[model samples]
Target: MGHPAEVEVLSKALSGIGVDEKSLVSILTQSHHEHKRTIKRGCSQFFVEDERHFERWNDDAIKTLKAEFKRFKALHFMK
Candidate 1:
């Protein structure tokens, strides 16, 4: 299947209050392992740009946000 902008999609998924966990799941799980690696690396831009958005959130959201990414890595990156 044709892949759209991997970074862009990931950026959107990671944007807004808290992480878009569902969107992350839909995108990461559908992509190949190599593509997942690409997504993992490309996540920097999203964090840097959206850092302010996440900053207002409480520590719990911060922890949950990390957990969300870890979930993505576990499901998509781990064999």
Candidate 2:
């Protein structure tokens, strides 16, 4: 079980990415242990770290978002 403060911080960070609190909770709770571990590691590494680390994480996240958007648009036109 995660600490309450950690959970709250994670929820707020996820919200910044446009994820709703309920869905975030559901995803975190229902995911595999490996997934949870990875997320916990990433949250500590990216969110709680210094500003440089956060900026780097944010930049990579934006790149991933762009790639996903491109893939989504490509699939949208498929018959």
Candidate 3:
């Protein structure tokens, strides 16, 4: 549950109908590298389904886009 509050905020930002880009940027940009790594690791615990599950999204294009962006941010910033 690494950084549960941060993880919850991130989960909220990525869940539901739309993304909270402001929240995402605020968290990712302000967090330390180690914190980002914790968040990245937490994502696996939270989103246990599968990364490719995002591609199966057909009901909402925005959701798919949001999910893909989430993946991108995780990969790009977690370094």
Candidate 4:
């Protein structure tokens, strides 16, 4: 629960019908690695009960978007 507001925003963005890539990028790119780790931890702790529950939150579109974002981030960080 480092940045509660950010965790909330991310939860909202990731929970719904569409993925808010802008907000995700904004918070993630602006955050330090420690902050990102905290946010990730907070998300699982607060928003998601467990891995199975979290998987239920993802539809096909969200899954694809998530994978794409991961790829993009990896490439961006590599540069």
List per-prediction Cα lDDT, in the order shown. Answer: 0.64, 0.56, 0.70, 0.70
Per-candidate TM-scores read: 0.46, 0.31, 0.55, 0.56
lDDT of 4 by residue, 11-76 (tens): 776665656778877898899889988997766633333565543332554566677678667877
Cα deviation at 55, candidate 2, in Å, is 23
Worst 10 residues of 4 by lDDT: 49-58
Residue 10 Cα positional deviation in candidate 3, in Å, after optimal superposition: 0.3
lDDT per residue for candidate 2 within 1-79, as digits (tens), equals 4445555656574544443445455667776777676667646543344555553344565565466556656766784
Tens-place lDDT per residue, model 3, 1-79, is 2478988898788777766777878988888888887997765533333466552323354457567687778876999
Clash number for each model: 0, 0, 0, 0
On residues 12-51, what C-alpha lDDT tens digit does candidate 1 reach at each position? Answer: 7666654677767788778887877677566654333335
Model 3, TM vs. native: 0.55
**Candidate 2 lDDT trough over 10 residues, lowest sum:** 13-22
**Looking at candidate 3, what is the lDDT of residue 27?**
89
Best by TM-score: 4
Q: What range of 10 consecutive residues in model 3 has the weakest lDDT sum? A: 54-63
RMSD of each: 9.3, 10.4, 9.4, 6.9
Q: Which stretches of candidate 3 lie over 4 Å from their true place?
A: 45-63, 66-79
